[model samples]
Target: MRKITAGFFHSVDGVVESPNLWQFDAFDDELGALLGETMSKIDTVLLGRVGFEEWAGYWPNAEADQDFAQFINNMPKYVASRTRSQADLSIWQNSTLIEGDVIEFARELKAREGGEIAVMGGISLARQLFFAGLLEELTLITHPVVAGKGKRMFEATDPVTRLELKRSSTTSKGNVVSVYGLKPE
Candidate 1:
């Protein structure tokens, strides 16, 4: 079975919005190292149209030009969309747009051969997957500072769903990385 691995960056108080106001002079090698190690373990990359567009541009250029970006470029990516949205699909050499019944498509994708499929949170879509009981493992990488006003990761979009904690830890950057797996049957 294919599992979902999420790497989200949030605040101490649980927030996953963007951080554009921080002042940093140099890259935190420790944090980057930790993130790199974690990312190296995953294979598949799944994202919504918004998140796909956001990452397809940068990550493909940052990593070894063939590491993370190459993985994103060559590996399978399932993007959830309703209105035929294709934002720079060129970056993803092997990509497919998800329409119609997403759960079925996602399940089919999971059944195929692969290591771990990561679901990059776009908030709305993550809630959809959470409600559908399709998510296996969730990894939330939380940060230290809180954004008073920004987008939230998930807000109970479904009627009712439960997730049991699996593992969690604090990163060197004072960030908390929480891992959650859906309640087993």
Candidate 2:
């Protein structure tokens, strides 16, 4: 069985949106290596509708020679959208639309034989998977900045979900990368 990992570039205040506003200064070779290593393990990407549309528009036109761009462009992408049809998803190469119950679909995907399935920066999809108990791991590359106000990674809600910190490290540029495993219910 494969694991579902949610990776995010976050601010010290837990903001996950618009990393470009705060992430540039803390992007070092060490962080690059770590992100590259993580990407190497992912064979499938799970994205929400908004993220799918945004990435599809940008990545295809991006430099194909770049390793990250090539990896993302070629990877099998599953867009979890209630509205997007197969024809709509086919606009992007190797892209598929996931309709109906997302939780069940995610579980089935995890049961398949493959490398890790990654959920990156899709807050809606990530929240659904996290709350559904479908996500196995969460990796946050936390930068040394307070976003003040933005879409936070985790919002306060009902019963809190507990995560066991598996590993943590600080980059040369003061970015903290932490990996956490979901605690068993």
Candidate 3:
């Protein structure tokens, strides 16, 4: 089965949400490249409801922006939500709401014809996979910034688990790219 790739940008202090969020625009080139590679590997993009709405709003019209105008415009997306009633999505050729059980569904998806299935945001969804030993690898890009407060990353009740750093590198713009795979027991 294909592995699950969790990719997110964070700060030096491990803050995924930074104060100067405008810099995200500049990261589009990097984002596009990364996402391009991701889509080349996996066809499915797992997203939470909020993130789903945010992405759907931006990506469909990314053509207006030079960076992700081409890359983000394409690629199938799936949203994990309980409240969402509509499944019709214009951004992706194959977009749908994750119905029924997600863990088993995710696994079934990875087993489909693809290279990697990416999961973004929906920390609750990620935590579910992590605790169930379903997540395979984590790709984190740490930017050089910090935000004192925002949405919290981890829940208080989550347990500590070990992951092995498989590869790491620093981008020209000083972004830290770290890839961690689940440690073998």
Candidate-wise lDDT, in order: 0.67, 0.86, 0.68
lDDT of 3 at 5: 72
Tens-digit lDDT string for candidate 1 (1-185): 87766666665556665644431322255557766786776676677877877776777567564555655666677788776555546556666787678778778877988787777736666766666777776677666665576677666454555678898766555666677878776
Tens-digit lDDT string for candidate 2 (52-94): 8888887887865488778988999989887889999877899
Q: What's the TM-score of every candidate structure?
A: 0.79, 0.94, 0.82
Query: What's the true lDDT of residue 110 in model 1?
Result: 79
- State the lDDT at 24 in candidate 2: 67
Clashes of each: 1, 0, 0
Q: How accurate locally is residue 152 in candidate 1, as Cα lDDT from 0 to 100? A: 72
Candidate 2 backbone clash number: 0
Alpha-carbon runs more than 4 Å astray in model 1 = 20-30, 60-67, 85-88, 156-161
lDDT of 3 by residue, 49-153 (tens): 777776677666565665443544455667788888554554454568787888888878877877677787565676677677777877777777665566545
Which stretches in model 3 have alpha-carbon errors above 4 Å?
18-36, 64-69, 87-93
* Model 2 alpha-carbon miss at residue 98, Å: 0.4
List the candidates ranked by TM-score, beginning with the highest: 2, 3, 1
Backbone clash tally for model 3? 0
TM-score of 2: 0.94
